[model samples]
Target: MQKIRYWVVGGEYTSTDFETLIEGTERVVGPFESRSDAERTWRYLSEDHRPQAQVRFTIAQEPQGTMTA
Candidate 1:
């Protein structure tokens, strides 16, 4: 099984990085069954931009079994 998770990467690496893991910024969208469905959700959520806010959406695949960070 797989789920579609959405994460936003913003700001400069020097000042701030995605690793900050801000709850408001980094979001988890859905558990789509198909890859295409997941991609679509990623695209739709990322369509809007703040112009100054350097942000992008990413897709992460969940591990099949137990895994560690």
Candidate 2:
């Protein structure tokens, strides 16, 4: 069985359009156990970078398991 996990990903984008993230600014914040925990982290990061118009963060989910071919 596979377990679902969450992560917070994103960073300063190249522009306000948010199409591309700056090379060194890329960030991936963790494998949280729950969505709420990820949301808490997302909120903190978003607020911390609030002054930067191009900074953004979002939660991403993935299945924790190996794939069989």
Candidate 3:
């Protein structure tokens, strides 16, 4: 199974605002079927929110599994 992590960067925004942004941006990086989904999600989140603040994706892979850190 693959896991995707989507997050926002920069100034803190309410969950509602972030959700709205994600809704619009998800398509840009999503519809993935593997671990690469995380990359797409991150790109979408970062690209959309980076301009407002500093943001980055921290991906960690484990021997048995992988997760976003």
- Decoy 1 TM-score against native: 0.55
- Which regions of candidate 3 are displaced past 4 Å? 1-33, 62-69
Provide C-alpha RMSD values for all models, in order.
Answer: 5.6, 2.7, 8.6
Maximum-TM-score candidate? 2
Compared with the true structure, what per-residue lDDT tens digits does model 2 show for residues 1-69? 555789999999999999999999999988887899999999999999999999999999975564343
> TM-score-based ranking, best first?
2, 1, 3
Better of 2 and 3 by lDDT: 2
Report the C-alpha displacement of residue 8, candidate 2, in angstroms. Answer: 0.2
lDDT of candidate 1 at residue 61, scale 0 to 100:
66
lDDT of 1 by residue, 1-69 (tens): 434433323322222353454445555665566667778877776675435244656666655653334
Task: Give the clashing residue pairs of candidate 1, or none.
Answer: none
Per-residue lDDT, model 1, residue 50, is 36
Residue pairs of candidate 2 with colliding backbone atoms = none
Runs in model 1 deviating more than 4 A are: 1-23, 50-52, 66-69
